[model samples]
Every structure is written in structure tokens, then in C-alpha cells.
Target: MAEGALFEFLCRMGDNTLVLGHRVSEWCGHAPVLEEDIALANTALDLIGQTQMWLGLAGEVEGKGRSADDLAMLRDAWDFRNVLLAEQPNGDFGQTMMRQFLFDAWHVEMLAALTRSSDARIAAIAAKAVKEAAYHVERSGDTVIGLGDGTTESHRRMQAALDLLWPYVGEMFLPDAVDAAMAEAGVAPDPASLRPAFDARIGAVMAAATLTIPEDDFAHKGGKSGFRHSEHLGHMLTEMQWLQRAYPGASW
Candidate 1:
């Protein structure tokens, strides 16, 4: 039971990184500016690297015949455990930045806490990932501030972007049964515990961006804890899983 719980937790982490990384990778050539394009691509590469580590750890923990590649490429859309925020369509440049800003802030806090996990391998992975995530958060926050406080059009677009993505943001804080069990075992941090820190960081960024937080009283939820995802995820999985599905046991 412990191992099963651990595997589930690890898969959740891996899937989140993998899906978000792929989403970000979509901007590799299409960013509004050249410098921003490079920045987004770099962030995507970092996330992809993080996914490799987490998925490899998950494979080891599962002690199954399945490898990281098999798990990542063979999984269906419904089988993915990433939050809806990560899989949401990249609406515009501002929209992408808003999504990244929210996700990176939460990710930084989660990785920092996970660095102290009781599980040695998990701790090591978190320790390494925390550095990467910290930079990602900083860069994303800077972009949000830049665009939000820039020209009138930029400001309006950024505000709209924030509103569109806010509904999905709640899922990052939603705790699941696996999370609860891991918290009890000192293998994971409570999602709720990270909220204050995440809020503070996000607030600071919004302030710097000269933007107001959305006043939506009712926040949408349920994506990571097994709720259905946006329509985008199905298309993403179809492309991502095609190779493995088409050529069973195919290898490099």
C-alpha cells in the first residue's frame, strides 16, 4: 500500500511536469518576441528535464516492467494526472505568461518543501528541481509585470489573460487522497500549507505588474484530483501517445 501510494504521488508529479512542459514547448517558435520565445523554450526544456527525473523515480518506485518512456507516452488523456491549469490552451502571450506565473509560484513552494521529504530520492529530485523552478517563477513573474504595466493594449490583454486562467488555478491547491497519505508519511507537503506562501508571491508579482487580482468569488476546481480536463488535453495526448501506441515495444 505504501509503495502504491508513493507511485501514485510520483506519477502525479511526473505527469504535471510532462504535460506543462509540453504545453510550454508549443511556444518555441510562436512567441510574440524573439527574446521571450527563447525564454519560454528554455523554461520548457527545464520542465522536460524535471519530468524525466520524476518519471524515472516513479518507474523505480513502481518496480514494474513499465519504464518512464512507456508510462509517459502510452498513457491516455484520461489517465494523465496533471492539473487543468497546466493543460489549458495557450490563449495569447499574456495568457501563457499568466498561466506560467501562477504555476511556477506554486511549483516553487512545493519543490522547496519536498526537498525535505523523508524519501531520499524524492528529496534529491526536489532539491535539484527547486532551483530550476525558482528561476522559472522569477522569469514568469517578470514577464507578467512587464506586459501588464506596458502599453494600454498589453495591459488589457494581460488582465483578460489572468481572468481566463484563474478558474483553473484552484486545482493546484486541491489535495487528493494520495497527497493526504503522503503528508502523513512525511513524503509530501500539504497542498493547503503552501497556499499562503503562494498567495504572497503572486500578490507581490501582481503588485509589481500594476495589475489587480481578479475578483471572482467562485473559483473553479477539480483537475488533478481526477476531474475531467479541458478539451486540449485529448488532442495533446493523441499526438504525444501516437508513437508508442502505433509501434508496440518500439525503442530508440
Candidate 2:
């Protein structure tokens, strides 16, 4: 049971990275500037690479016949364990930056905590990923601050992106049964414990960006716990899973 739960937990992490990576990769040819385009694409590659590592580990933990590709490409939208924040549509450059910033902030905190995980594999993966996630957080945070403080129009767009993406941010810190079990088992970090660090990092970035944090009177939650996601997830899964669905066992 512990191993099964661990596999599920790892898959959830991988799925979030995979889906968000796919969304960000869509901007490669469409970014507003060449440098920004290259950066976004590189970031997407890093995230997808991380996903592959996590998913492969998950497959091993599961002790099942499923390969990493099978777990990623064969899963339907309902079966995916990714958060809604990852599936939310990338509205504009500002929106994309905001989305990435939010996730990167959470990831940095999470990975830092996971470095202490009792599970050697989890700790090792986190140790390696923390460096990358730290850079991701810094880059995205810088982008947020630049756009938010750049000009009237840029500020407005950045503010709007923050407002739109804020609701989904809550899910990152909301702990679930799996999280509780993992925390108890020492296989994963308790997300709740990471909240303070996440908040400090996010608050500093928002302040530097000259952006106000959104009010949380009604925080939207329920993603990793397996609730349905935003409408965009279905479309994303269609594109991502189509080849595997259409041609079972097909590969280069």
C-alpha cells in the first residue's frame, strides 16, 4: 500500500510537470521576443525532462508493466493527476509568466523540502531538481517584476494575469490524503509545512513586481485530490495523447 501510494504521489507530481511543460512549449514559436521565446522553450524542455524522470521513477515504484510513456500518453483527462493551475490556458505573455511564476514558487519550496525526504530516491530527485527549480523561480519572478513595473500597459496586463491565476494557486498548498500518508511515511514533504516559505518567496516577488496579491476570501481548491480540472485540460490531453490512442504501441 505504501508503495502504491508513493507511485500515485510521484505520478501526480510528474503529470503536473508534463502538462504544464506542454502548455509552455506551445509558446516556442509565438513568444513576443526571440530571447523570451528561447527561454520559454528551454524552460519547457527542462520541465518535460523532469517529468520524464519522475514518471519513470513512478513506474518503478508501481512495479507494474506500464512504461513512462504509457503512464503519460495513455492516461485520459479524468485519470490525470495534474493540478488545474497547470491546465489553465496560457492567455498571454503576462499570463504565461504569472502561471509559471506561481508554479515555480511552489515547486522551489516543495523541492527544497523534499530534499530531506526519508525516501532516498525522493530526496535524491529533489536534490537534483531544487537547483533547476530555483533558477525557474528566479527567472519567472524576474519576468513578473519586469512586466509588472515596465509601463502602464505592461503593469495592467501583469496585474490582470495575477488576478486570473490567483484562485488556482491555493491548490498547491492544499494537502490531501496522499500527502498526509506520504508525510507520515517520510516519502514526501508535507505541503502545508512549505506554505510559509512559499508565501515569503511569492510575497517578495509580488512586492518587487509592484503587484498586489489577490484577496483570498474564497480560495479555489481541489486538483491533486482528483477533482475535475479546467476545460483546457481536455483539449490538451487530446493533442498530447492522440498519437498513442490512434496507434496503440506506435513509436518511432
Candidate 3:
């Protein structure tokens, strides 16, 4: 892959975690249960920590002076490259679990494949991330199964969550030109190649949960190209970047 393309790819990877971590962090002290509150907080920390590693390496690759903090706390929402799913709002508990399960499954596959990346830096990061991703998947999957198979109200909510989230899942596997180049160069895994496995894993979780995937074929796109985003991102960034943006260059 071209150096610039690779840098962009890394940025997308980092941005996904950064945004999703922020979303999960919103659950801190507000989850439906204390156990889940702590669980989501820890999950958020893992994702944010991954964001630091990925963005720090992106800076190294771009040969820019920017640090992970700069990328995480400075960039505007329009510049972010996370998949639409990652930036999507956390709805009810079921929706949040569904979103986490979907991303966790895909992330595990992506990171596992990335551990074999020709780029040593990428491989090292993926090696560590895969473990965390696996745990995320297990936790999310179990929660989904429990909720879906629980009360009638929970079953309804879980089913609705699955439907709402299904379309966004497509974006995770849509490969662009940059992705092609990186895959060819062994610096990145082919996103499309991860689709079948993603589908299988997701299907298994859904089956255990007794939830049905949505029938809608339409899917949102363009977060990676920065051409499309939900309005939620601006609000999210306003809060996430407040300290850094309000006091530029302020440090502890």
C-alpha cells in the first residue's frame, strides 16, 4: 500500500476504537446493573487504550508530530474514519449489547488476521488487541443471549436492537481502494475476506439469542471516506474534545 493510504487505514482503525470507546464510556455508572456498569467501563478502557496504540503508530507512519492525544482529542468528527456502526448512538441496553457483539466479532476476526500482518507494528498491536477483542465478544454475546431469551419485553427489545444494527454491519466488510492496496501489500487484512466468518459468528450469537437479523438490504456507508456521518458525532465530539479544544496545549 502507498504510505499515505496505509496511514489513512491506520487512522480509520484507531478512530473506530476511539469513538466506540467514548460511546461505551457513556455507560459508566449508568448501566442497567452495577455489574454491567463496571463491565462496560472496563471495556471502554480497553478500547481507548487500543486507540492510543493505534493512533500513536499512525502518527509514526505518517511521520507527523501528532501524538495519540492529538488524534483522539483534536480531530473533528468529519475527519473521523470509524465505520458508521461505531459512531452510532447507544440506544437501550439491548442495542448497546448488540452493537458491541457485532463489532466485537468483526474486530476479533480483523485483529486475528492482522496479527499476521507483514507490518510488524500492526502485527504487534493486533496481537495484543485480539485478546481484548475476544473477551469483548464473549461478554457481549452472553449478554445478548441472556436478554434475548429472558422476559418478553427483553426479547422484543433484543430483536429490535438486532434489526436496527444489522444494516450497519455491512460497512465493516466493504473494502475500498486503500483497503485493496493494503491487503495486496500485506499491511492490512482484506475486510471482505472477514465477512463470511463475521456472518457465521454473528449468526451463531443471534441463534443462541433467538434474535432475527433484519431483512433490510440497504446499508449506510462513507464514514471511512468522511462523506457521511450521523449527527450524533458532532455532539459526541463536542463533549469528548471539550477540554483539549477549550484549552489548546494544556497539559497535566
RMSD of each: 1.4, 1.2, 0.9
Better of 2 and 3 by lDDT: 3
> Which stretches of candidate 1 lie above 4 Å from their native place?
none
lDDT, model 2, position 35: 98
The lDDT per prediction is: 0.87, 0.88, 0.91
lDDT of 3: 0.91
Q: Best by lDDT, which number?
A: 3
Candidate ranking (lDDT, best to worst)? 3, 2, 1
Across 83-197, the per-residue lDDT of candidate 3 in tens digits comes to 9899889998889998999999999999999999999999999999999999999999999999998899999999988888888888889998989989999988889999989
Best by TM-score: 3
Model 1 TM: 0.95
lDDT (Cα, 0-100) at 111 in candidate 2:
87
Could you tell me the TM-score of candidate 2? Answer: 0.97
Task: Write the residue-wise lDDT of candidate 1 on 1-252 in tens digits.
Answer: 379888888888898899999989988889988998999899999998999999898888888777788789987877777888888888888888899999999999999999999999999999999999999988889999999999999999998888788877777887878889999999999898999999899889889888888787455655575567778889888877787788987878
Residue 201 error, candidate 3, Å: 0.9
lDDT of 2 by residue, 2-97 (tens): 676888799888998999999999998999999999999999998898898899899888887777898999877777888889989889999999
Better of 1 and 2 by lDDT: 2
Clashes of each: 0, 0, 0
